[model samples]
Target: MNKIKNIHILILLIFLISIGQMSQTIYVPSIFNIAKELKVNMEEVQKLMSGYLLCYGISQLIYGPISDKVGRKPVILVGMMIFILSTFLILFANSLELMIILFSIQGLGTGVGGVMARTLPRDIFLNYENLKKANGFLNMGILVSPLIAPLIGGIISNLFEWRMCFVFLLIIGILISTTIFIFLPETCTKKQIKNSIFGYKILIYKKKFNYYLLILTSGLSGIVVFESNSGVLLSEMGFSNIEVSILFILPIPSIFFGSWYIGFSKKSFNYLMWKSVILCLLSGFFMWLPGWFKIMKIWTILIPASLFFFSAGMLFPLATTGAMIPCKGSAGTAGALLGGIQNIGSSFIAFISTFLPKNGQFSIGMITFIIGVIIFLCWWKLSRLEKI
Candidate 1:
């Protein structure tokens, strides 16, 4: 609308969506190194992840509603600045105590860009099919970053130090901020939220919105429980950082399949959602198999995990697009609430998975199975309320 090319603005949005993951994934492989430098055990080292995720999830409650009021570009620009400043500060952390606090603050910045990034697609496309295609591209960016983040982090940490991950983030912040300032345009049609906290009631009160929110929560939680732990789990199985990084990339083919299915298939959103729910059940079963067998091959984890994430990745765009559909006035707030639920749900589940028995992978599988069943049952019951 601002006469900027849609392609340019869209590319910027996809990149911005990667912020939360890049913040954590790039440093995930370095958790052990961070523990060594900070003098802590692995269980305690995990709290850093929990702290960052908690802040990232909680801050989205504010980011979405505010974006609706202020317009999207300026909110993202300010967030980028906050992100850069916070990452720069982390470069100076000398103790685990200071690192935890800094990373928690970093999560605050993580909330800034994602709320608006998810909103802008609806702003631009304004049609369901086109939005799905746009969301496919958006989901691609989201999934691909995880594939690359750890690889990049592993290489950087191996060549330099874990702190270099922040250096990478600093450059990304500057670049994305510059892009938003120069090229990205405002996309909101109205500001309906009077108060951010109370605003969610308006959204949740919408028929089927809460169902979609619950679905988003369940979907992301499934993926994160495995993702947050996989790097460390693979490392414990005696693989090097590079090996874990490479194995993390195995899901790419399936994820691409899922994205492609959502973007190109003519199936109704209902059809897609049902397919995803079933996949979650199957994925959970397979995810549990690796730990059940007590086998340590990367393939044991990789094959089942790929199936689950493929469905998860496939569901990613659908869940987002569907959830925001009914809330026309508060797309920002809608996207924010959905994102917050997703991050908070996934973070909590992921953190809990790390603490579970049998070094967590077995519990990870059981939880994944249990959650998948719950999601299916919720959908089955809610589908009777009204068709999504």
Candidate 2:
């Protein structure tokens, strides 16, 4: 019975962690539909993602501390309620501005998942090996959202309308919230740290943690920039919505492989970090080289982008575990900062990508290259420092 319960909890946590990414990506295939329906331009419609991401990232700062003070369950429940309400309300938003507002609110709600998913694993798994295994498994499951969400979004948008996408999210919100309310127990045992600032200071003071955080942020931002721009780029290349959705799935397998490899490999974290950084730099080179010669094709984009995704897959788990393991006592705060800062960085990059000239994939390639360079520099600095 205890084994069965553990399995159940793991499954639930997977769902909880997946909600944030699912919310972000499921409606992505509908961006063009949204722009046309709301009489907005591409830049304006992209705000829906940027707005949600900004609030999603920022709200974790609050949820993380509160979950530590209160319990994880209540904070999660409240966030789900907020997400459900906002998702339902978004279905009625006829203007881009209104939709952006509701989406941002929805982000605020889903942000709880971002904090708790990482924190709860720390709370439940006392052993480091067990925690690392759980995190790797959770990350593998999280990858499924991006794999399937755009496909679903494309099919729904093509058959019905984009608003139905929100309807689907509403249903999912109700089910997840209900399940959590019934089954999830409060996992935080040490809630004595009342001052959130102290927790922040503890984490921020660590040089290793700061370096890992920036490395994670830079790699993740490349993903956001690609996802933020890819649909429109593919559409311009004459692909239909469904086709674009299919193409989005192409790079995901590489990510899955990278995630799987990290679990079994005996390589030092530093070695793996360097390997991933090199792959990203190579990925960036491929991404940029094609655009430089005006020979950008579907394969050029997808194949090179897969290299980056593979690197990200490796980077996320390593960087997260490297940063979080040392701060186990302040799991909630550390989880919040880890998740929050990365999303906030990605949100900033995504917002900026919208303003870049839409020049046959040059913008995305350049952005990816730039991010790779940034990651390399951060990793070099981190490599010189002593491990925490």
Using TM-score as the measure, the top candidate is 2
Q: Report the lDDT tens digits of candidate 1 across residue range 1-388.
A: 5334667777878778787678877877787888888888766677677777777877888888888787777777777777788889999989888887888888888787567657777677766777778788788787777667888898899899989988988898788778778876677655443345577888878756777778778877776766677877777877777777777777878888888888898887778878988998898887787777765566667777788878877788887777766566677788888888777887788778767763636777788888788778767765676454
Give the C-alpha miss distance for residue 271 in model 2, angstroms.
2.4
Number of the top candidate by lDDT? 2
RMSD of each: 2.2, 1.9
The TM-score measured for candidate 1 stands at 0.93
Which residue pairs in candidate 2 collide? none
Global local distance difference test of model 2: 0.83
- Give the residue spans of candidate 2 off by over 4 A: 1-6, 190-195, 386-388
| C-alpha TM-scores of all predictions | 0.93, 0.95
Among residues 3 or more apart in sequence or in different chains, the pairs in candidate 1 whose N, CA or C atoms overlap within 3 Å are: none
